[model samples]
Target: MSYAYPRSTGASSLPSYTSVPSSKTTSESWHDLPNVAKQWMVEGAAVFQTARSQDRHDIRRFASLIFRRTFTIPSALILLWLFTLWRGERTVFQESIDACAWENWEKWPQGATPHRVAFIADPQLVDPHTYPGRPWPLSTLTVDYTDQYLRRSFSSIQNALIPDSVLFLGDLFDGGREWATSTTTSPEERYQKYTDSFWKKEYGRFMKIFLDPWMDQNELPIDGRGRRLIASLPGNHDLGFGHGIQEPVRDRFQAYFGQSNRVDVIGNHTFVSLDTVSLSAMDQVDPQTGGTSSVVNEAYPDPIWKQTNDFLNKMTYHRGRAEMGELRMMQNRSEGIQFDYRIVEPADSAIYSNDQDEPVDLPTILLTHVPLFRKPATPCGPLRERYPPSSTTEELEEDEPNSLSISGGYQYQNVLTPKISTEVVTKSGPNVVQVYSGDDHDYCELIHREFNGSPREITVKSLSWAMGVRHPGFLMTSLWNPINPETGESLQQGSSPTIQNHLCILPDQLGIFIHYGCILGLSILVLLLRSSFHVFFASEPALSNQSPVLPLSERRGDSYKHQYQTSGTSSSTLAPNGLASRASITAFPRYPVTKASHDAYRNLDQDDLVTTTSKDKGGYRPARPRGFRQKSVLMGREFVHSVRVVALVVLTVYFFLIWRW
Candidate 1:
């Protein structure tokens, strides 16, 4: 049966990326080799022509080059072999280690459905209260760059990309106490909630300022079928400061935007948007004493993290259980498709069309604002790093895995959760192919590098350049399937979905010219140095007995006869007097006196020049074989040069490959 994809919008004219053709490393073909490489071969051919001359010295010069090449070719081959190996630190995101079949994309079937999703991180929306003469210094906190550039870029992305879904890896609010009045601006007032009028104003302001694309101007859902799917998870900011998750903030967030943690099922796939703050809000172990603690007794604990563990556990089991009917029901509940204002019911006919067959297990892509992998303690975001208590206090807490930071310093580490998320990931088995996270507001893709296997972590750029950080862009992901040509159905059961992550550049406050300019300048310097060295060596004089050129390619046609015979049988042709006759010889020439060839011969001294037309005379004679002693002497010299060639080759390989290995 044929297939249909949801809301596949085609462009009028796709942007052309074909300028100055070059391919990526993983995708390069043999055809991509440059035309300049062929020109180099021809240039080398024009330099060698004197081997066809009557001079036997030129023939020896050509032999010496051959001797050098024995070393040169082997050395180049060793360097080329070394270039194929990646000598960098081990990364689990390598295609060799990834658990999914995405590396084998070519083997998959064609015409599969492509699902596009855009990931944004840490808008950190700062909407200060406009109360008249507020006691607090809210007006002093002026960050104009975040206000101007970030909001404009998000609007640009929404209009330009028009993705199927937008996962806001949240830290959406700067200080999320909009409802609190001016009178109660103290630290204690952080937990206090205002009247209903305050919440209405807060929601309205947020929609207009930050999230206009997801809804209409009238504060209603847009009925453009398969329109923008909005999913957001709480960052530490969404809760109050010092891991403060107030009841009012949590309740209002759910009332407006569905849930803090949500599962979205689009077609056959499932995407989980998790509240990382809720999961990691409570520290299970005490820093002072090496013992387990409850949320109430813990130094930093709350109701958010306590319920988050239980909520995630139930949800994990609800989806993973093998029973088909209940599993389908769980997926349908999270289905993002809509007929009108509300989500389609579980009994909807359209939902059952493709899912008519017994429900089979599929991949689950997980997203968390706080990464499972702990990041470096170096500060990059707007959240300034003060002295953290656990980091400074030299306490009796026991050492843990590599995930938890045990360093006694000023920087604090985000400790491990109750292992609920890990358990869910482990129980999901092969279905969990990839995990993405954000809170750091810096781009980092890490892998667990487990003995069995692990998925990749793709952390994205923040929307704002708050702390003058480097990266500021959202991730665009394309999820597609391998469609079987014969059956026309996607090969989703055994295969993994193809995910392509693209980092779309937003405006950077600091330009990239300096970074790229240095690289370009270095490349030019290297090229100039190489060319200068080549010319320097080529202009130098040849060795005392060597020829200026060698006719390396035309060796078979040309013949050389030495004027003085060294062989025993050729002694009759030698001068009777024992004075060595001037080494006069006839040559069967390969290089005639053409303009190009004449210039090469013009460099020779008058004594070295040939007066007679050797080609017209046709007086070519082969020299007789030398005596055993003479032959042995020639063999000894050849053997010595060969040994030198082998020595150079060994040295070259040792320097290039052995050191790296």
Candidate 2:
């Protein structure tokens, strides 16, 4: 005898299956169904029925089955690894770096290697003390998370690009200048507090975030020498801009991050890092006198402005000396004379070369915190955002105010004054190929018409997500000026180095959060639905009020197996409806059978016996009402589903926390 599923007879509305032909075997009947029907059969029977069920599967059995299936197919493990480890912080950061392709330094002339510098700007690490109105815990979390982000960014840069150097255009701390300036007590005590707070407390955080041990600066080589970390320019946030600058804050920042004004020579190029913030203060009206102080006048003594002016004068002298030395070396090389490689310019030597009345354009890269002066309506390039001009001009007129109005409040200035900017460009030398600055906290690229050569200036975007812009980014630059290996002089005179700049933008963190939030919500909903698949057959409307006929012996035995011994009958014969006399009729376990129903069924007429059961005779029972036990089972199922959903959420959070790790 073969067993097959029965056709649906109108009593069930949940779902119906077509009956398998009784003449065919179970496997043969299933194989005979059309492919399209087969697909519908699996979907309708398995998925729909499971989804429609009101009861849950047994927890232990379900978990065991899943555990076994995992060994055969590791898709669950693979998905977990994909979401957690593969697509994490390193990948996100490296992908952004990759998007901005590096200039092919390998293809350049062999003698002088090109210098690759990664520019990081305006990290402006959040300090909780800066905002008193916010909750302390939230502020702490913001600080921690920002630090982690920077750590990952720095780590990824070290691993992926491995630049010859990393330049930190300032705004290193949000509260660096504010620390000791607050008036709470005597100057001595306040100064001590500032030292303890900044050097002792915040210093650790700064080092941990930006200077991971693995990112040892010396690991990368430039022109056969170790690399350098240039953090010269002090930000307004670090030492306060213009007249608001405090001596103590300036001293501490200089002590830690190096002098605000300095020069670095690498790979036949000059990097002039100027303290424009201090220089802008030179013309402010003196409180002692009604007249403004002049930076050019040697006797006009305002100590802060005086120091920066003296530095500029000294740099101008150095630029003149370097130019004269290089010119003399070039002349000597032509005549085939062995000249001293050590460059020294005597006081009598001419600063100007005989070839041109205009000063020779030097290959220099100027780094500053405040950008050089520009008109308010000047159009920053395509990547510029936040109040961009409606239309753009390719060039700004030279006669227009080469200076922006020196308007500023507490700790910042909009731009350097025209006089200070001119001083910087002149002292920085005639051919400043590029100028990089930060403080606007967004991307801006425009030509400085006042600077010799009208070189491009890029105001790098901030690295912190907390900064107002939607996309935060950094700049990658490659400077290649090939030089003779023996003399260390430029092989091509009168030409500036090949400087290429590319901006690599980071992923939008807000958008990432929204994406993860959607995934979390959808996951919980799917898990809840999956937990409802165990009671479909029992809960069906057709099965609820109807009594299914069962063979007498099997009904009495309450088992799958049976023998024909009904009411002492001896003959074993077919039941005439093509069923074995002793064969069993299937009934759901949910409908219980009792001894009293046997006698009730025996007395009923044949037609009524199978189709209907009298309530008074008690042959067939309706599905039992949901009780305390059934409700408890449902509660347990809900609890398990909740647990699975919570696990997914926790995993997501954990992935973020250990992303860099």
Candidate 3:
């Protein structure tokens, strides 16, 4: 008996082996085989090696093919998703503006004529270093982008609505505050620095971008004859410090925008642009000796008390210089200089006059930065007595009532009451005064009784331009003939004022569309990756058609045989008779059973035979081996196939959702 070991072949080839046995009784002798048998064993071993190498190569190739196919579909889908987002954004933006339709005059209040007015406010051009400059931290709300959107939106409104006039109300620039100069710098240097740095730099940019373009288009006479309809009022920010009360900055503003602060008629409507930056009487007062206490009846008692108390504590006597150029006080009697203009007379007298020597008798529309009479009885007139007398030296030492009753001694007693004695003034038997102001940055309409006993209506409309920081909107108004409510017909007096509040809601629908589209695209990508992972890696049942049965059986049997042959020889030994024997042996007998035997065992009445025989003479019987269980390879294959199917379904759903959105 002999056994032949497998010989090594080339690196790419497998080895061969053979085995033969001489005796059937002893298992050790059976393992020793003839040369032919040994040769066959060697050949079988080589075949197994070759088969295993080929199997590994096939597995690698299969994996590579699967990966390539899986990614191809996803890559194409992603490209399509991105393209959809781009197109969606563009379409939404363009279509949103086009969808808005202008309202017709007839559709408005009956007998009402549509008068479109453009309200522009708070250009708020900021210096990069001094103020919180443009390109604010908020997204899509940066100065450049916001300004561009505004310009386009304005153009749309103009083209679609065709406004009659454009009004610019205040705060065009961040104020000029000198860091190097003390609060007491010369008026000339202060004014010059403000004009050069802040006013010119910040506001200059605004003008070049918006105002200049507007002026160039509309400044020329319309239809070859009509007056240009662009008007501007000075804001405190533009007038530097001291709330536009300074003479130099005030004069400069008047020179640039216009010197006329009174009312003027424009196409049957009067427009009044007022300068509300003049100093109050208390602003010109001194708290110490009371020599310059020009505030006859100090309406603002809080500041008067603070200044009076401070002077008494310091034991200092001082006088205020009334005629001093550019040196004016605030209404609170705080020590500060005026910024822009001087009040040649009191604010009340400067505001109105009915004397033949004064300008009057116009259908007036008053435009001012600050609201008139922020508190009750604070209107320009006799209401001044409701407050205390100007700070006096004796009064400063003691706490006393700052308010006063009507007294004959004070000529300026009624200064805060009224400049005109009536509620309304009439020219040719019709009311001629209407007030228009912008400061609250919101729309309001107020009717108040004037000193002249006539009804005066004031319309306060706000135009906010600080883009996106707050409400970015404007007011659109129309003047229509009053209508009869019952019949819906025009009234005898055909014109009634109507206002429409318009706000820029979204950053041109295009921007919003683009933003959402990006979000949707990212979501799709996440879903696709997740599905691909589960399809390839999840453990599940396999499909029945995955692998051939014969190949799987052969491969599994070969692997087991190779493992046993490699490890079993080391545990075996040969005896003196040239036969292999184990040092210790144990065996357990098992009953040979078939399906027929099992049925007979369960049925007690079934005929059966039982016999006893010598252990050595027992006939060889077929035995069902213990510890052997069938594995469900078919089930595993089906599970894997199911996973792939599920992944495909999920991917389809994801793609459909994206398309719908």
lDDT of each: 0.47, 0.63, 0.39
Q: Estimate each model's TM-score.
A: 0.45, 0.65, 0.42
Better of 1 and 3 by lDDT: 1
Per-residue CA lDDT of model 3 for 587-637, tens digit only, reads 223221223333323332212222222234222211211211111222233
For every candidate, C-alpha RMSD to the true structure in Å? 26.4, 14.6, 24.5
How many residue pairs of model 1 clash at the backbone?
5
Q: What are the per-residue Cα lDDT tens digits for candidate 1 across 1-661?
A: 6543232122211123213224555225323444444334333333243333435787788898787755553344344333322221112112212222222232324544455667888777644422224344544444443454554565555554456667777667655544453343314453344544565665565576457755422222121115455645766655542234556666666677777766565433556666656555455343434444334555544445555556565554434332232244434543423435665456663432232333244456777766664333322222212222233344323222212242321112232343644644664444576777766666655555441256776667787756345446777776664433232245667555466766655544343324334533543454334333332222222111211122222223335322322322232223566443334333333211234233323332333422221133233222211244433333334333434544465456535532432
Instruction: Count clashing residue pairs in model 2.
Output: 0
- Please identify model 2 stretches exceeding 4 Å from their true place: 1-64, 67-90, 101-112, 129-132, 181-195, 213-218, 287-291, 295-302, 320-361, 385-407, 484-489, 493-497, 528-640, 644-660
Give a tens-digit lDDT track for model 2, residues 1-661: 9535444322232244644445657657666656656655645676666755523556666887777656421234335434744454446766776776564333455565677788999998887435645696888877776777677667667776787778889888876766763332113343344543554467677877877633564465554435777776789877777667777767777887788777666555677888877777776765545556673445544456767778777775555445445545544543222333655556434343333322234588888899888877566656765545443564443222322234677657878877778888877876788899999888888887766789788999899877887678898887787655444456676654477787878866656656667765665555444333332223322222222244334334333332222223223345678554433333444311223233433333333313233344333333222344453355345545445545765667566656636
> Clashing pairs in model 2?
none
- lDDT (Cα) of model 3: 0.39
The prediction achieving the highest TM-score against the true structure is 2
The order of the candidates by TM-score, greatest first, is 2, 1, 3
lDDT score at residue 475, model 2, on the 0-100 scale: 88
Once superposed on the true structure, which residue ranges of model 1 sit more than 4 Å away at CA? 1-112, 127-145, 177-202, 214-225, 241-243, 285-302, 316-359, 374-421, 427-430, 482-497, 510-661
